[model samples]
Structure formats: C-alpha cells, structure tokens
Target: MTALSDAEFVVRTVADTACANEEYFGQLDAVVGDGDFGYSLARGFEHVLAQWDDFDRTDAGVFLQKVAQAISQRVGGTSGPIWGTAFLRAGGKLKGHETIAPADVVVALRAAVEGIQARGQAQLGEKTLLDSLVPAIDTFEAETAAGASTDDALAAMAVTARTTADATKELQAMRGRASYTGERSIGSVDAGATAVAVMLEKLAGAWPQR
Candidate 1:
C-alpha cells in the first residue's frame, strides 16, 4: 500500500518545483508562447500549498480531487484546467483506496495521462508536457514491473523526462499557443515538458524517504 504521506510528499514536491522554477518555465514558453506558463503554474500551485491542510483526507482520490479544485479555481488560462484534470483523474483512479499499490500507480498514471489528453486536446509529439510525461511514465511502469526500488524507478523517470523534454526541440509545436508560432517553435524546448523533467528530478532526490 502506498502511504498517504507519500502521496502528499509528491504533490508538495511538484508544487514547490513549479513555484521555484517560475522564471525558467516562463522563459521556455516565451520561445513560442505568451510567456505566462510559469507564472500561471506557480500561482496555481501556491494556492494548493496554501490550502494544503484543508484538503479532504478521505482517500488518495479525494485528496487529489481537493488539489484539483484548488488549481482549477486559482490558476488562469488553459493551464488550470489541464493540470487540474490530471490530478483529478489520477485521484479518481485511486478513489476509495486508502492506500495505493504498484498496479494502482500504473492505472492512476494512465488515467492522468488520458485526462490530460482529453483536457488539453493533445497527443504525443505535440511539443507539450505529454511529450515528456508519457515517456517518463512508460519508464516508470517498466522499472516497477522489473521490481526496481522506488528510487530506481524515480531515477529512470527523471532521466526519461529530461531526455524526452529535450527531444521536444526536434518536434514542431502541433498544439497549444505554441502551434501559432509555426515553424519558429521547432528550435526550443517545450516549457511544460521541461517542467515535467524538473518535477521528476525533484522526486528522484526525495523519494523513499517520503
């Protein structure tokens, strides 16, 4: 069973990372977007942190649902709905479970991915977060099935995220505001994808303990 504490730690890590790298994410987005990506994410997650203790602890699903509420209500533009949907779907997948298992982890992640796709109307190679996120989750599932320790799985995920995020430089922006930049978006790394890499790297350093 995955401890509630562990889930809390991961969510908190994601929020902190988003807040800390606000400028960096904005810079990435500035290459092809309006440059508000970082600011939006940071503000949304800050609200999540502010409401941390008030979140329902009925189960992992309910807890994440509360998180989704906070983000959707606080964040602006497209980011709020997309990011909130991810947590909400993940939480839904784990609903009723006071704890999560490795298999549950897989399903929850898959659900989150699906939610992102539906909400963002994005697919792979779109030069979005999914570019990194999908590959990283694939690595995560493989490592878990191989009986890797949590640290090992997280390590692989970090590497995959960083690698895939960088690889987005080779793909044209096919979605989001970046798509409006046309061929000009091809040369820059995706802001959302890089953010995913950063978040995974943060998790790699702190997993096992949480």
Candidate 2:
C-alpha cells in the first residue's frame, strides 16, 4: 500500500478503537486525572474520519498535516498537541514517499516517538505515553532488523505497546494532572499510554495482511 493509504488506515483504526473504549478511558481518567481524555480523543478522531474522503487525493505528508491541524483545533487538552505532534512528525518523515517500505515504517515510528517525547518532555518510566510508544518503536525497529516484513514488525510493535501500557500500572506519574496524585497514581494504568496501545492494536489489526 501507499504511504497515504497506510496513514489513512492508522487514523481510522485509532478513531474506531478510541470510540469503542471511550467510557472505559473516561472512568479511568476520572479517578486520578482529568476526565476529558475519552471525549477529547473521540472528538479528535471524529474530525479525522470526517476528512477521509480527502485523504486518498492528497500526498501522504499533506494528508497527515491536515489531520494534525484538524486534531489540534478540535481536540482539547494535552492529547491534541501530543497526538498532533506525533502525526506531524510522522508526516514530515514520510514526505515525498509514495509507497512505505518496512524501513520507512521504522523511520516513521521513530519520528513519532521523538515527537511525542519532545512535545510532552516526558521519558520512559515516567508513566506517560512514552512508556508504550518508546518500547513499541524499539520492538518495531528490532523486528525490522531481524528481516521481518512491515506487517510482522507492526504486529510485534502492537504487542509491545499493549504490554508496556499494562505495565504502567506499577509506575508513578511524573507529568500531567496525574503527577499531582503522587503515590496514588501507582497501580493505575496511564490513560494516554493505554490509548497509544489501543491505537497500535487497531493499526495492526487493520494491516492488509494477517
């Protein structure tokens, strides 16, 4: 598939997954963090789906640029900027690419991780989205290096993302509103990390190959 198609699939899958787990995230966030994560993600991705008709007509980079802009404008709170930056960085890395190779997927994922880190200024073990994204990227890179296809690499990455997100329950929050909970934040999965894992799973599921 073309890079544009891959991005479109990723966006649609993320939106769908977020919609499916909206209430779960809301309840999770209501306990230790702001309760807007689910609503914000739903709204942001709703806007993304609304623009799907335009995706195939545009270049991959331009399509993602538009998605980033739309999400930043429509989605409220930290998710807007963090998710927007992730797409924008991935789009930047995909510039001028028609079809995305396995290596291209690796580069795009690395750019996404870097963008999230730069935007949130949070690192691994901080109980943020990085906990999921960083390990997922690492797994994708490792799989690619091991001669895996794009589909296989993404599948491995999805598993790593989910595992890392679940492991966040043992971590203390170091950023965002969750940080205020101090030790109370421990034993609760980071909503953002869970959301990232959800997205990764959705993307892997949507992959054309099994």
Candidate 3:
C-alpha cells in the first residue's frame, strides 16, 4: 500500500481503538487523576476521524501534521501535546517518502519516542507512556536487527508493550498527577501507559505486511 493509505489505516485504527476504550481509560484515570484522559483522547481522535477527508493523504508528513494539529487543538489535557508531538516528530522523519517500509517504521517509532522524552522530560519505569513505548521499540529494533519480518517484529513489539504496560501496575507513579497517589498508585496500571499499549497492539494488528 501507498504510505498515505497506510497512514489512513493507522489513524483510523487508533481512533477506533481509543474511542472504543474511552470509558475504560477514564476509569483508570479516576484511580489517580481527574478521570478525563479517555474522554480527551477519544474526543481528539474523533475529531481526527471527522476531518479525515481534509488531510493530505498523498503526503504522509502532511497527513500526520494535520493529525497532530487536530489532536493538539481539540484534545484537552497534557496528553494531547505529548501525543501530538510524537506524531509530528515521526511524520517529520518521513518528509520525502511516498511509501514507508519496515525500517521507516522503526525510525518513526524511535523519533516519536525521542520526541516524547524531550517534550515530557520523562523516561521508562516512571510509570509513564514510555514504559510501554520504550520496551516496544527495543523489542522491535532487536527483532528487526536479527532479520525478523515486519510482521514478526511488530508482534514482538506488541508483546513487549503489553508486558511493560502491565508491569506499570507494580510501579509507583513518578510522573503526572498519578504521582500524587504515592504508594496508592502501586496497584493500578497507568492510564497513559495503557493507551500506549493499546496503540501499539492496534498498530501491530492493522499494519499491512507488504
């Protein structure tokens, strides 16, 4: 598939998955936050889906820029900017590409993770989204470097994302409002990390193997 089609499928899949899991995310947030993370993410993606026709699908970079804009503008919360910046950074790396390959995917994920780290000043084991994303990227990179297929690499990444996200349940929140919970946060899975896992899992399922 062309990069544009692939981008469309990815955006649509994430939007659908986020919207479907909105309430659950909110519940997780309620355990440690204002309980609106799911709502904001769902609304942001819903806006993206609504404006799908306006995106310049022919250009992957343009498509993602528009998506980042929509999310940053419409989504109400810190998550909006963090996620938007991730997409923006990843998109920027594909500026001249008409089609993206598995290597491009790895580069994009790496860029996105760097963007998040820069924007949030956070890292793994802090009970943030990075907990899911970092491990996923590591697994994907290792698998791909070992000559795995795109499908196999993505499957490994998804597994790492799931495992790491679940492991957040054992960590005391060290970032965001969840951190305010102190020891109380130890037993709950991080809402943001859960979103990361969901996004990765959905991407693994939706991405086409050329």
Q: Whole-model lDDT, candidate 1?
A: 0.92
- lDDT per residue, candidate 1, 1-210, as tens digits? 354666788899999999999999999999889999999999999999999999998877888889999999999999999999999999988778866767788899899999999998999988999999999999999999999977898899999999999999999999888999899998899999999999999989888666
Model 2: runs farther than 4 Å from truth? none
Model 3 — which ten-residue stretch has the worst lDDT? 201-210
Pull out the clashing pairs in model 1: none
TM-score, predicted candidate 3 vs. hidden true structure: 0.94
Give the lowest summed-lDDT range of ten residues in model 2.
51-60
lDDT of 2 by residue, 56-112 (tens): 446777788788887888888888999899888888888888887777877877888
lDDT of each: 0.92, 0.84, 0.86
How many residue pairs clash in each candidate at the backbone level? 0, 0, 0
- List candidate 1 stretches off by more than 4 Å: none
lDDT of 1 at 52: 95
- Alpha-carbon deviation at 126 in model 2, angstroms: 0.9
